[model samples]
Target: MITNDAMTVQDQRTSKIILAIAAITILLATFAGKMPSGMIGALGIMVITGFILNYIGDRTPIINQFFGGGAIVVIFGSAYLFHSSIFPASAEQNVTTFMKSGGFLAFYVASLVTGSIFGMDTQTLKKAALKYIPVILGSAFFACLFTGLVGMLVSKSFYDSVMLIALPIMGGGMGAGAVPLVEIMSGKTGMNAETLMSQMVPALAIGNAIAIVMAGLLNKLGQVAPNLTGNGQLIRGQKAIEEEDQSTAPLNVTTLGVGALLAVTMYFVGTLLSSVIDMHTYALMILSIALIKVSGIMPTALEQAAHSWYKFVVGNLTPALLVGIGVAYTDLNQILAALSPMYFLLVLITVLGAVFGAGLIGWMMGFYPIEAAITGGLCMANMGGTGDVAVLAASKRMELMPFAQISSRIGGAFMLILATMVVQAIA
Candidate 1:
C-alpha cells in the first residue's frame, strides 16, 4: 500500500507535470497559428499564466507577507501582460469572448451563490440577513462621505467625488455594478453611458486592488487581536462557526452532478425573475436560495450534496476564475491612465472609509470588526464577484463568502438607487 506521504509526493509530481505541459502548450500556441480560439485556447492560456504568476507571488517574501500573496500578482501580472501586448491580441480576444459571451462567469457564479446559500446553517442565514443590510449601509455611508470630503479639498466637486470615485468602487463588479449605474447616469446626466463608464472604470479597478490588499492586512489584524474577529462569522453567538465546509456527505461524481444541477436551477430561477424586475440575477438568486434554506424546504442529503459540490468548485476553479478575470476584465492601461497622485489618493480614501465605517459599526452590533470589515466593506469596494473571491481569499476567510455575496449583490443594488438619488440631488 502506498503511504500517505508517498501519495502526497505523487500528487505534487502530477501537479508539476500538469503545469509543465500546460506551459509548453501555451508557448507553442502563442507562436503558432493553428491554436483553437474558443474555450480550449482560453482555458489553456489562463491556466498557464495563472499558475505561474500565483506560484511566483506566493513564494516572493514581501508580496506573500501582506499584499494578498498570489491574488494581487495574478491580477496585476495579467494586466501587465495584456497592456504590454505580450498576451497576443488573438488570445486576449479569445479569452474575453469566452468569458463574457460563453457564460463561464455566470456558470461559475451560479454554483458559488447557490451552494453557499444552501450550505449555510438555516438559522444563521435567517438571523444574519436581518442585520446585514445595516452593515452595508455603514460601509457606504463612510466611504462616500470621506471620499466627498477629499473631493472638496481637491479640484473636484463633492458630487464628482461621490459618483465618480466612490459609487463605482462600492457598486459591485463590472456588469452588476458599473454597467447599470452607467445607464442611470446617462438618463440623469445626459452623458453617453459608455463615456460615463469610461471615466469611472479606473476607480473601480483601483478600489478593488486596494480592497484585496487590505483584506490581507485585516487578516493580520485579526490574528494579532483575536478578540476582534469571529473567525469567519459576522454575528456573534448565533451559530457563528462556519458550517458550509462541514459536510459528511459522500463525495462522488453523481452527487457533484446533483449539486451542480441544483445551483444551475437556482440561477435559472433568478434569471427568470430578472425578466420582471430590473435587478441583477445574482441578487435575485441570493434571495431565492436564502428563502429555500431558511424555510427548510431543502433536504439534509441535498444540503450536504451542495456543500460537497461547493467545496469541489471552490478548490479547483478559483485559480482559473482569477485568471479569466485578469484576462477578460483587468486593464492595466486603463488603471495606469487613471493613476495620477490625486486619483489614487481619492480612491484609497474611499476604500479606507469603507473599512473603518463597517468595522466600527460591526463592532457596535457585536460582530467581529475584522470579519465585518472584510465582508461588508472590502467586498463592496471590490469589483463584484471576482473581487469578492480575491478579497475573501486574501483574508483567508472564504467561508464568509456568503456574506461577501450579500454585501456585493445586495449592497451593489442599493448603490444604484443611491447613485440615482445623488445625481438628482447634486446634478
Candidate 2:
C-alpha cells in the first residue's frame, strides 16, 4: 500500500474525486441559476469546455491532423452547444457578454500584438514589413479573380460574386470588415444594409471556418515540406523569434504587471490615434508599436516584460478565448444554412486563392510561404480579430500575431477601398 505505484494511483484518485466534485458543483450552480457572471462563471465554463474539446480534438485521428485540433473543435463545438440548449441559456449569454462587452477578445489580441512585436528580431521584422503589404494585395487579387471566375460559371454574375462573396469574405471580419462594407455598399447602391449583410454574413462565417481548417492543413504541409515554412519565422535567413529573451532576467510579478500595462496602454494609444487617423485601432497600434520598437525608445526591460506577458496570455488563455469566440461570434445556424454545394465551392475557392496567392508572393518577397499564407492570407480571410487568433492558433504560429493583425486590419481596409472603387466603376 505504501509502494510508489500505489501512492501514485491514490493521488490520481484523489485528484479525480476533487475534479468530479468541482464539476458537479459548477453544474449545479449553473442549472440552479446561480452561476456568477463576469470572470468567475464565464471563465470557468469557457476553460472547462475548451479543455474538454481540446482533449478530444488532439486525440481524434483525422481531426487532429487537418482540422486545426482543439481550436476548431472548441469553436464549432461551443457554437453547437450554444445553440443546442445543452448549456444553460444563461451560461451562453454570460459567455457572449463576457467575450463581447467584457472585451476579452480585444484584451487577448492586444497582448499578442505588443508582445510579439517587441520580441521580434528587428532585422527580420524590418525585412518582412516592407514585403508584407504586397503579399496581402496579391492575396486579394487572386481571391477576387478566382471567386469571380467561379461565380460567373455558377451564378452567371461575375460582379455579384466578386463584390458580394469574395470581397466580404476577405474584408477582415464582422465589425470592421463586413458590417462597414454593408454600409458602404448600401450607401453607394441604395440597398438595405440588412440585405447586404445577409449576403456577407454567411460568406464571412463560412470563409472563417474554411480559413481555420486551411490553417491546420497548412501546418501539416509545413511538416511535409519543411522548407516552405519558417515554423513561425517570416523570413528564411532569420532564426525563429525566441519566445523568451535570453539576456533578460527571469520573469517576476513586476515584469508581468509592466507587460499588462504596456499592452493596454498601446491598445489605448491605438484607439486614441484611430479617432484622428482614419484607420483601425489595431492597425494604428501596430504601426505605433513598430515605430517605437524601431526607434529604440522602449526600454529593453519593458520590451521583455511585454513579451513575457504575451507568452503567459498565449499559454494560458488561448483555449478559453477560443471557447468564447465560439459562443460569442460563430453562428452554427448561419454556417449550416449557407452550406449549399455551390456556396461551399465558392467559399473554398476564395480561401484557396488567398492561400496560394499569398504564399507565392510571400516566397518572392523572401518570407516563408506557409507563414505568409497563414498570416497574410488566412488571417485576412478570417473573421477579423477573433479570426486572427483562431487562424494563428490553428497554424501553431501565435508568434506571428503582428503580421496577422496587419493582414486583418490593413488588408481589410484595402478591401473596402477596392470594393468601393469596383462598385463605382461597374455600377
Candidate 3:
C-alpha cells in the first residue's frame, strides 16, 4: 500500500521510537562493570542519551534558537542527569572509567587531529599557520586587559585578575593551562600550588561553559548576517574545498584499519616529541602533521585515506563523544560553587575580550569573524579538547578543528610565557 519512500520514512520513525525507549531504559537500568559488558553497555547508554538530548535540544525554544541544537543539550543534559542523581553512580563510574582507562577520549581525539591536518591543502596549511600566531597573541592580550579592568572595578587587584582569571582561560585547558600556572604562581607569589589550582580551576569551568553558549550565539549571528562568516570556512577567500566532508570511501575495512593505525602512530610520535619539547603531546602531534601537510610529501592516496577516516569518525562518533563529554568533563557543580559577582564578571569579561580580539584581527587577516571568534577566541577560553568539540559542535563548524588545536596548544604555550613574564614584572 505504501511506496518505497513512505516505507523508508516509516522505518525511520520506528527506529526513532525504539531508540527513545532504549534511551529511557538506560536511565532506569542497574548496569554493572565487567570489562567488555561494562564498556559496551555504558557506551550504548551514552550514545542513546546523547541522541535523545540532541533531539530535544533541536526542539526546545531558546536552546534551539540561541545554542543551535543538541551539542549544548547533550552537555547540560548529561550534567543535569549527574546533578539530579538520575544517572546512577555505578553507570557514571562505568562510563568515566571507559572514557579514561579504556581510552575512548584519546582514541577519538587522535583520529580527528590526524585527519583534520592531513586533509587540508598544503598552501592553505602554510598560509593559516603563518598568520595564526599573531591572532592568538591579540586574543590573549585583549582577554587579559578586559578581565583585569573588570577585576579592578570589582575590588580585586589587577595582578590577581591577570594571574588567576585571564591567563588560565587563555592557557588552553585544565592540565596544560591551570596546572602549570599553579606551579608558576606558587613560585612567584608564594601561594600554595594546590590552593591556587582550586581557585583557578573554577574559572576554566565557568569560561568553558560561557564559550560554548557564545559559540551558539555566534552561529545565530552568522545566520542573521552571512557576511560575518564563511559558513564553515575559516579563511574568507578559500572555497569550501569540500562540502562539509562527504566521505564516500565505503567504510572499507582495510582503509579504516590503515587510518586507525595512522592516527595512533601520529599520537605516539607526538608523545615522543614531548620529551624534546615542553608542549603537550597533542600540540606536538599537530605540529608534526601540519609540517607534513604543508611539506607536500605525503602521498595522495594516504591523504585521501586520512580524510575518509576523519569523515567516518566525525559522522559516526561525534554524538557519542558529545555524550562522553557530558558525563566525563562537564561539571556544573564546580562552576556553581565558584560563582561570585567579582569572579564571575572577570571570567565573562575575559571570554568576551577573547571573542572581540580574535574576531577583529582574524577578519582583518581575511579569516571569517565567526570562525575566528569560535576557534581563535572560544577555543582559548574553553577547556581544550572537549571544549573545542563543544564549541565547534555548537557553532556547526567541526571542520575548523585544526585551527582550534592551534589556539589551545600554541595559545596555551603563549599563556605560560605571559604568566612567567607577568609574575616577574609584578614581583
| Candidate closest to the true structure, highest lDDT | 2
Q: Which parts of model 1 have CA positions greater than 4 angstroms off? A: 1-15, 190-195, 238-245
| Candidate lDDT (C-alpha), each | 0.83, 0.90, 0.84
**Candidate 2, 311-377: lDDT as tens digits:** 8999989999999999999998899999999988999999999998999999999989999999889
C-alpha RMSD between model 2 and the true structure: 2.2
lDDT of 1 at 343: 94
TM-score of 1: 0.91
RMSD of 3: 2.5
Query: Model 2, stretches more than 4 Å misplaced?
Result: 1-21, 240-249
In terms of TM-score, the best-performing candidate is 2
- Residue 95 in model 3: shift from native, Å? 1.4
Please give the RMSD to the true structure for each candidate, in Å: 2.6, 2.2, 2.5
Candidate 3 C-alpha error for residue 124, in Å: 1.3
Q: Could you give the candidate ranking by lDDT, starting with the highest?
A: 2, 3, 1
Please count the clashing residue pairs in each candidate, in the order shown. Answer: 1, 0, 0
Candidate 3 vs. true structure, TM-score: 0.92
1-427: candidate 1 lDDT, tens digit per residue: 9999999999999998987887887868775755688888787777778778888888988778777788778877887786578767887788788888988778887887777777777767777787788889999999999999999998889988998889989999888888888988888888888788888899998888889899988887887788888777777774434543354677999889999999889889999999998877888888888888888878978877777788788777776777778878887777779899999999999999999989988877778889889989999999998888889777877668778888998899899989988778866
Q: Write the per-residue lDDT of candidate 3 for residues 212-310, one digit (tens) a residue.
A: 999999999999999999887777877555442234434587777788888899989999999998778888999899878777787766776777788
| Error of model 1, residue 141, in angstroms | 0.6
